[model samples]
Target: MKTKRGKIPGFAIQEMMVVLAITAIVVGMAFSVLNLVQRQMGSIEDIYEVKLEANKLRQSLWIDFNRYSYVNFDERKGQLYFSNELEEKNYTIIEDMIFTEKDTFNVQLEHKAFYFKNHEKKIGEIDAIELKTSKESGHQQIFVFKDNAPATYINHKP
Candidate 1:
């Protein structure tokens, strides 16, 4: 078919197809970019969550260490218990999560580890702890607790 083009304000089939193809390409690119941005945002959120958990762990540990006369970790039970002459408090790490006594509070922490130093250590006192947490998004944090108590080391619960 002979096409006439003289200010008729019309587009041929080939031109329309080309335009549609370009539009589709642009839309596809936009969607892919959006997907990448979404993934980055999710990564950022995961990192933020990990940071919050680390802060909570540090603050809680500080309070527990100060308030109690002694603190110990039960390796077999995966529980960290702090006690004095009368009151005893405990927290258990289960399936990469932390659970506490009294209120059954829980925090999701992936790849979490706690290391303790007891009186037997050459450092002369049981006054240091290490906490490490990591996430699948490659976010990792390590917090170390120094001996600040006045020659105090709490006993582990039986």
Candidate 2:
């Protein structure tokens, strides 16, 4: 090989083309891998969002179940009431959503069951609740329970 400068030798045109081609191929492969990783991250983000929503719903229900001494539900009105000695809390269910005084949860319910002392009840006082929710990934079941009913609550006739 000879250079245009006549004294110093340099890379030939064929060698330069080979290096450029290899660089382009490597860059192309890197871009493809990056694209694949980006798509996977997007999907993972969506799954995390779904799981977060589920956890929020579960925690809220658990807190209310444990804090309240009395729990009641009106099936016809789609209203759930939780009460202690001082304050009362209400939860309303309409369609695929659950609404509280503070926030609303977008949960698609597949089924719901209420129980009092291990006996299933349709409408009225309850000690436990089971919710079967539907999500994009799969179905999930959430159960919230009150440990012991207050004597006055259990004795009261409603």
Root-mean-square deviation of every model:
7.0, 3.6
Error of 2 at 4 (Å): 14
The count of backbone overlaps in candidate 2 is 0
Query: Best TM-score goes to which candidate?
Result: 2
Candidate 2 lDDT tens digits, 31-117 = 999999999999999888777776788899899988988899999999999999999999998768899999888878888999987
Please, what's the RMSD in Å of model 1? 7.0
Candidate 2 stretches with Cα past 4 Å from truth are 1-5, 150-158
lDDT of 1 by residue, 115-151 (tens): 4443333222234565445544234454545554544
lDDT of each structure? 0.63, 0.86
Which residue pairs in candidate 1 collide? 70-154
Q: What's the true lDDT of residue 102 in model 1?
A: 46
